[model samples]
Target: MDSIRLKIDSRADQVALAGRCIHALSKVVVGERAAFEIELAACEVINNVIEHAYECREGNDILIEWIHRDGELQIDVHDWGRAVPADVLFSPLPDIDHGDVTNLPEGGFGIGLLNALSDRVEYRTDEDEGRNTLSLFRRFDAAGISR
Candidate 1:
């Protein structure tokens, strides 16, 4: 098992960090396709924190950790931000109305994608501490590849 921790400042930095992690893990985990899926999933979660958690506030820190063990991948993302609303947390994707391009919102897609890509997704928030934690998990096969 291996673990790495990083503190990211900006959205671009977060994406870069995700890319780096993916590159490092890919060496150990086989199958480029599965690796790319995991990397994309991580990017969506990290970007969510960068855009919504801090609301573009400067100096807000996001902590990202990756854990690999027993043919499984675990990613933890932590941030200090306003507590996410319970409704928003569990809300289903909105149905497309007439497929109008302009009517569609740019946001909410990330959360939807995260839920779809990862095998497991969990969230924890402490209002008093203003902490939000997102945990993602994907189980891999003996070949170090996910299904």
Candidate 2:
């Protein structure tokens, strides 16, 4: 398997750059739609690291690894800041069935959307080492699957 690793400041502005890198890499194997899906999921993951893990701090580092092997793509987002809450990883989807768009919740969709876009999601955190990794996985071939 081949991998591309990127390390960037945990800033909101850098999320787009990371997303673009993910999109470009995924496009080669999964085409546009699936690539976009992967990119969006990745951006959400990065944003959560910034907003929650780093508490919106600017100087922390977030490392993203894009790995492709055996017809699968795995995106690993690593952070050395605050460890993610154990329960957040398995949180259920947001309750958007209010039948009123204006009454919808503004937040709480990050993990859900990440889960929906990728075939699998894994979260690992080691407080002793001050490391957290959020891995998003998807299976694809040359022709990719549609959403």
Candidate 3:
């Protein structure tokens, strides 16, 4: 599989650069629709890492990789700042009271959105090593299916 890799310091300022690259690459293989989906998911994952993974610390780093081959696209996001417990990061998002916009939650949609938009979503973490890996996959060929 041919892949493109990007390494960024875990800072908010660098996210835009990563997003542009991911969008451009996805656009080439799956066109704008798939690419936009990828962008949304990628942004959520990156933001979560920056805000939570390195929480209460500074100078962490993360790497994003795009693997494309045989009509499949896999995104692997890795970080070494802090390991998120599977129960927290992999669980489904809690239902919010949307009827009352005044009481709406400020967060809690990252994993669910990612799962809803990708064919597969998997997360692994090792708290002792302060490492986490999130893998998202999708098929973009003629048989491609929407999330």
Q: Which stretches of candidate 2 lie over 4 Å from their true place?
A: none
Off by over 4 Å in 1: 90-105, 126-129
User: Could you give the C-alpha RMSD of every candidate to the true structure, in order shown?
Assistant: 2.6, 1.8, 2.4
Span of 10 residues, lowest total lDDT, candidate 3: 138-147
Task: Record all residue pairs in model 2 with backbone atoms less than 3 Å apart, i.e. clashing.
Answer: none
- Candidate with the larger lDDT of 1 and 2: 2
lDDT of 2 at 111: 81
Tens digit per residue, CA lDDT, model 2, 1-147: 999999999889999999999999989888898999999999989999999889999999899999998779999999998888768876666888677989898988888888889898999887788899999999976456544
Supply the TM-score for candidate 3. 0.85
What local lDDT does model 2 show for residue 37? 92
Candidate 2 similarity to native, TM-score:
0.91
Question: What C-alpha lDDT do the candidate models reach, one value each?
Answer: 0.76, 0.89, 0.81
Candidate with the larger TM-score of 1 and 3: 3
Clashes of each: 0, 0, 0
* Residue pairs that clash (backbone atoms under 3 angstroms), model 1: none
Candidate number that wins on lDDT, 1 or 3: 3
Better of 1 and 2 by TM-score: 2
